[model samples]
Target: MISDDIGKRILCLSFNQTNTCLAVGSTKGFRIIRLEDSKTIIKRDEDSQSNFPGGFSLVIPVFSTPLICLVGSSSNARYPFNTVYFWDDYKTSSEAEIHFRFEVKNALVRRDRIVIILEKITYVYVLNNLQALASIETISNEKGVGAISYDKDIFVLVSLSKEPGHLRMENFYTNEVKSGQVHENPITYVAIDFIGSIGASASAQGTIIRVFDCAKLEVLYELRRGSRPAEISSIAFSPNQNYLVVTSNKSTVHAWKLEKKEKSYTSMISRYLPNYFQYSRSLGKLSLKTEIDLTCPYSNITGPKACFFTENEFFIACLDGNIHKCSIHPVSGEISIAQSLQYFGLSSVSVVERGRTWNNIE
Candidate 1:
């Protein structure tokens, strides 16, 4: 459904948690693309002469407002400054202006606050009033933080170390640290579902997708893909939490289904293959009741940088600068390509279904 052709390399993308607007980040600057008319309504340009000409790491929509977009950027490493910029722009404006700017080591935006992980410390800024609500020290041997996720009022921080990766959950409001979990390897990516009922994490190896219960702090399921070494590039949960779409360093995407039984969550690999292949050899044919397959209308395509499920449909943003639409059945792990379009410079993608909000109301 992406119609605009503002072809540019996309670094990060996010849809406002509450509205129909989409924010896209690239090497140049951030753009607010409106869904209503398929146009770049608000474009924020980076000043070439400034110390930091807008190198954004992520763009997050304010929880209940679509017109406001939260942008996070690090000061140019070559320069001496280490700061974060918060640019707020009206949807109807042709250009956006900076509303707030703060000096920080690293920063990420959650539903209610902006989490800034510094060189040796971490801080959370409440978005409502722009106040420092909580702060914690990041303890690890590794130089930088890996991934972070926010569920309900709890914030989970994944830090890398020479020994093993550490996962710690903290109550944002009370600043209470919960139990800490360890991973065999460094964590690379993490994502939580809309409801925060389920969550998924990946490691540097990109072989496993660890699914857990956010409320109980228990591992619910795990999905393992190929044997060759590959890093998990992205992970996203379907709107219903019934399916998880994962893309890796290899040109393949794996969809997993979560089955909740009794007191545990189980994961089944629904799809585990590349979208296009030559299919040179067939060993044999066997009787099968049902079969599921997905084929791109075109072949020899690069895998997408990000993917997510919306309303039982799958959307993939390919490195070739295209967004593919497909039909997916979460229960069965079945996927079929519906259509595709070429819109270059697509770095990331996030889907906001017809009716969903950060407040947890349908």
Candidate 2:
């Protein structure tokens, strides 16, 4: 059962790295929900009693590891708002913890680093020891989101630029900074590919999504979510970087194919296309601006959460406590709803793109 409703309210829902396991946090507590029998299976009934810090229990599962974590929130919670805790193995109690001086705005985990976004600051910490490595005073809005390139290689934080409406990205390792006036409208969402080489952002205009190659500090592509304004819930790239999945308030998900000419007219003197080529079709741009709905034939919701399960299959979660498995046909890009599980929480959903089996069974 997708029982995020077990406790008082659904706080957070995330899939572990392998997608075989899911972590559901509720106001009362949390539990590890195993995806089996084409449904959400809870291990124990007592797992619902939780002591998570009140407010936004934005718990996130560690990729490639066995950790279910959350940055405690709200101003009056028992756990300080600035603390980050590891609910190791979906236990009610946290097994390991870290603290910060400022409240966490958002956080992202990539390989060995934990990128924490604070109201005015961003901190990077080593995962093993929770040691502070770097801190940058950010001009980013308080709700800025962080993106990690697949392979957990590069980390990108969308921070406000000093010059208004512009955004800057500061590297945690190289300390290199890339800045540009990306959009006139406020940035609505941010995304990065596996290597952190490519980044995408959608402006408040909501109709357009822009992709950037941070290495060159230039835009490589623009995608239209719709002609009308819509709230973007999420933007994720498949592991292979072949497809980009986008979810919006319209209760629809769109996956756009990344265009790169595989068959060059001639090997020599071939033109080079960065990711956002506005030029030739053979360049690094998305050949077609068209996007097919991954959530076709499905009704709308407040905002559906979605992520890729495989190159051809993806999953969508709606507030109605339902999860739909959607798949794309090879070559044709035809989308079909393969299955629907009516037992799930109405919260953000995560799928473990890679599997590593480790669970706490006490």
Candidate 3:
């Protein structure tokens, strides 16, 4: 959860599988907003008797439906950290609940599957019946690094953790498990494209973002975001999977063109030079237009979050509750802002003293 400790607001935010809507959790509760018109379709408040008194730390919508998977945070927690509630907004009540012995670090819900990521173990369950499907052992995944495909054919990626930068992938359609190292340093962010054919990863070093061909477990492109080390906030692929957007604490969102194979020049030059020559630089970059609350404890809050509305357009949501609609010029690689909106009812407060960094808490 990306929270302002002074106010304890804005716990977490997630986009539905279809990318048509967004769910934002805060100290007050959670709200579902439609991306098309930027309207709040459903707003649940903690004070509501039907809803939990404590606000949610995480809320993941199940494929743009009225159902949402919710988890609580330590601050004003109503639900236990180890519990996940399947809440039906239509019925205004919980449909089911699942409890684990260990606290859940993150939960990913798609189509008919639910993935609960703990510190060192990941559990997969069928969404309909809540029946256990599989359990995997992972390394120290304190950051809860994991990603699920948006397509019906599920491809899930998680940190193997056994090694510093190793990744394990599961293709449920083929029942195949692939393990490979996506980064030399510990992975800080991971994302799968709409169809799950492409995977992207960034290391804690944050200088390079690597795109992968999940089927073959091979590197497709090594994209250089910058030369300095920063914490990666989010990595997302375009709808068509031809480009990617990455946001970091540096306040610059980078856009990169992806390819399954290196350019002829890269391959030809790499043979004569060092392998670093193969790395591709971003095509364009967007500096966040709005101010971010630096005192915010969570990177997910302080760091900008972006997702594509189309291959050429995207929305950047920030800690101040401002969403910037932006577009990129394909040929020129120039990024432009289309519009900016504020969540009228969302809490956007500034704090005096900086709180503990989220990395330590997570």
Candidate 4:
């Protein structure tokens, strides 16, 4: 049975490389859970100053490394938020800490680097030595709290744009920016596959989700989330890239296939019609404007969040302290609850691999 209050408010969730373990952050604190069942592997207490000020607003595990972690919270807290702490075992003591004059809002970690996202600016650090690598100023959102990461050196985030919604992408090793405006509206959600070749983005309008190839900066396809003005809470691509899963303020989710469909003469006609298929000048490709659902384990509330549990399954968490495991049918793309667990108040959930079970306390 799922608890009525696993976490009061889940602020953020992150996954490691293999997606076998999960890092959950909430009002209670932060916890590492094994996905085979809801077994807690480790926990950090929120009341302890050594652990955090308020609670963990964000938590990210270093890829495949159990001992390393990055967290963010209130700046005035005894622990403080202006620095990204590199905890060895517990939050109280850190093997290495990266200090910032600005408060850190979110963070993302890769194999060799960790991205520290502040309210106004973003910083990249080499994971091995915690060296400041690069800075990006156009980012408009928090961090990729639940965003995906590639094994290699490419990443994406929402960027501030005056004309249209823009995504600022970075090839960290090359330090080059690949940006595009897939939607005319404000971009709300973005995702990249496990291999890092494909990318997806959604908007406040919430009607259309644009999928693109990162290498060419080309719009590949669109996954329709909803027709109304609903905010998308989560978007994830399967490990195999066969399906893309999305959850939102509503109760249902939409999973679209990446496989190409048969082209119609209308599709061919739209290709020649620039206005019909909004073409990107930089990449010379057409944008699909198709807007389009399946249900989840939990009933819809103010917001429901989700991530890929397997290549075919997904989990949605609700505020009432319940995590529902839902599986999508291969032929029809329908979702049904496999089981409901007694976990409570899980604000965010991500799949991770290995992490330390020790605490931040002395």
Candidate maximizing lDDT = 3
Local distance difference test, each candidate: 0.48, 0.57, 0.76, 0.58
Candidate 4, superposed: residue stretches over 4 Å from native: 1-9, 46-53, 90-92, 142-148, 152-163, 174-176, 269-302, 345-362
Per-candidate TM equals 0.64, 0.72, 0.89, 0.76
Cα lDDT tens digits, model 1, 254-344, are 6666655453222132234452221111111111121111111111112344445365555555544345565566445566666765432
Q: TM-score order of candidates, best first?
A: 3, 4, 2, 1
**Candidate with more favorable, higher lDDT: 1 or 4:** 4
lDDT (Cα) of model 2: 0.57
TM-score comparison, 2 vs 3, better candidate? 3
Off by over 4 Å in 1: 1-9, 18-22, 34-39, 45-54, 63-81, 91-106, 139-163, 173-176, 261-311, 330-332, 343-362
Sliding window of 10 residues with minimal summed lDDT for model 3 = 353-362
Report the C-alpha lDDT of model 4 over 163-264, residue by residue, as the tens digit. Answer: 347766665444556766778876766777766677777778877778877655578876556456777776777778887776666655666766776788
Model 2 lDDT tens row, 190-269: 77765777777777666777777866558776766667788776676666767766776666677677775455555233
True-structure lDDT of candidate 4: 0.58
Q: Where does the lowest 10-residue lDDT sum fall in candidate 2?
A: 281-290
